[model samples]
Target: MYEIFEQLLSERGVTPYRVAKETGITTATLTSWKQGKYTPKPEKLQKIADYFHVSLDYLMGKNSSLTTCPDCGFTYDPSYPEDIETHIEQHTAWEKAVKEFGEIYSDGVKCEQIKAENRKISHDLSLPLEERCEAQIRVLRCLFSRSLVANSYSLDHVPFDTYVAMMLNNPSYRKNNLEDDLLQALIDKYGTASGMNSGTIYHIPNKSKAISTKDKRDIKRDLDRIMEQLSNQEYGPAAYDGEELSPEAAELFRDELEIALKRLKLINKEKYNPHKNKK
Candidate 1:
């Protein structure tokens, strides 16, 4: 029993000082037990067993079986030699798998914590909107660059021109003219670049260029479409021809349309007067 206790301590690399501190057992009692001069009380034995995560019978030398299977929670008996070997092997594999899983779980927790911190930083309202947007763009660029590198591919292999062509050729992608213009500019700059290094690809010669005629026309077209849709809704199947809406529904729709029109006016003003708010 004393030898088994000593072996457990050795396996865990725990010194007597640590064992005494952790289990609240005295050094004198441990020394006496090691010398075969004293046996611990049942309560003390239980404390020691619990601390070392071993069964009391195993600690007391009454059970000289292999360690309990971590999977099945059963000790292997020598009486069934063949079964014992297989059980011990399975227990060993289970221990290794558990240790590996613990490491992976720890890494996953750290990654989630990092993502939360990044989200907080990215969405901070005090930062200028342009600064925040640029920061997010840089992060996205880094992620895409790293992904390409890890896959042993280059920008040439999956050219920005190809994506732009696909988007421009698809009517769904052309629905938002502002986004389409931005995508076109990006494709023009980086479509033929050898790699995805932002420093090399993002150096446009005319960063302050005005919105093109096509973009202006597209914006007007979108505004006209919105007004047409709202007009249709006002007199569509939901309403009676030449009949006014109920007062409540009329007020609700009026307020919503007013707000939407104000937003559209603001966007139009901003598009034409880009320097209006600049110092």
Candidate 2:
């Protein structure tokens, strides 16, 4: 019984000293309870149980579940929901997909194919309970990534990866559509990973994968090309147009374009060139 109380305390992030201080139970008494040296008095047990939102039966190990469910096969949580068969089914589906798709690609691939793979492996494959939980998380993460890419234009101020992870972890997050409740939970957890407005997230397309560091390099290359094109446009046409801009027009253009030029200069100055600075 006291062992149960100790487990609950750890789960709730409560220190024995804190519990002792709050309940006016002595440190030695709490220590004894933890070591199974003494069972707590009824009133003390009640106080501890109430504080932890656990039943006395749970605290005393009379019942194994922290919250009992008749249908759940397990006596303990495995980091996924119990009493919900869908959770287990989801794990099974993910394991099937993994066996079919290989490691990284399993999550990003099409669900129908994944489901098919799951069918193929249905007779031969069996994951341990912990591995099943991890597989579910992977599938969920992939699904979330795809959803974010689909709606990236509408989303505001959310990092692409965090948003995807949040949606996957949330049980009530709907498939094929972003939910406000899920978004709110994301905001709460990540506290605005982007600078954009909150409501704008709805317009963004969901992405299938996170923006890799290599992708950032590609984006930078594209931007550099655009900058070159713009610079050539601003300066090259004088040689091509068969006439140079008048001094006054050129001066006006330079002044008007000063902000953009400065921006380009900043980008050039800060750009990280891996080839040039090899370790």
Candidate 3:
């Protein structure tokens, strides 16, 4: 118990002194706990748990309940009733999806031939911007040898494992529509809000997990905003006029995409996934 308390303090980057100051747990009380002279009462444990935005069970040294689903690879706890419900549901969906949509696993491999070609392209430094963009996309396809080839020609090159699917932020309706099954699968995989707050956490939108609106309004709103932002977007010669995009520019684009995705209700803002139903 004392070890768990110490771990919490350490993980939060706070000293026992700071914890005492902020949580109003006296130094003597904490010291007693540290020495294992006394077990912390429920009230004290509650305060500490609340301070960490965690559960009392967690403060009492309970192990995380999360386990990875074999089919979807999403994490959820069987202990939580809600998790068990959604767990079985998603697993079933994914089991069916495997046969229906097929699978594209991400295996990070670089062929020597492709690697040399990429190197040659980089070393040459005189390729047209359009050419470079095309080359980079090709590189994307090559790296993910099992890239999905069903959808759009260019987009088929964009492969995904669970992580990549989790981070999908394409604002284009064409991309989203083409990748409808993919998005649905993601929603199905990380669908439950059961283990979010008090159990194991999965970072995703409240709107996504426990759906607030059955209408799915947020998705449409976000799509509209994305369309507005990228109203005239098209295939470009390069990421920039004549050079690869600058880090700042790239970061800004990422930020915009993240904001849109979250607003679109595909991500969560906090460690506590409090939302309760699926969108």
Q: Which candidate has the highest lDDT of all?
A: 1
Per-model TM-score versus the true fold:
0.25, 0.24, 0.29
Report the Cα lDDT for candidate 1. 0.50
Ranked candidates (lDDT, high to low): 1, 3, 2
Estimate, for each residue in 1-279, the C-alpha lDDT of model 3 and write its tens digit: 788778878766789888778888899999988888987778988888777766676677787577775545446654344455555655554455455444522222334466457645633447654455444334433433322211111221222343233233323322423234434444454332222232111234333334332113344456556544453345542254455555576556657765666554544433434453443
Q: Write the per-residue lDDT of candidate 1 for residues 1-279, one digit (tens) a residue.
A: 888878888877888779888899999999998888999998999898878766677687785556554343334554333345445544454455334322111122343455455445545658655554444333333333333222222222233333334333444423422243344544454343222222212211122333332233344456556545554566563332445556566556556655665556556756766345443
How do all the candidates rank in terms of TM-score, highest first? Answer: 3, 1, 2
Worst 10 contiguous positions by lDDT, candidate 3: 149-158
Number of clashes found in candidate 1: 0
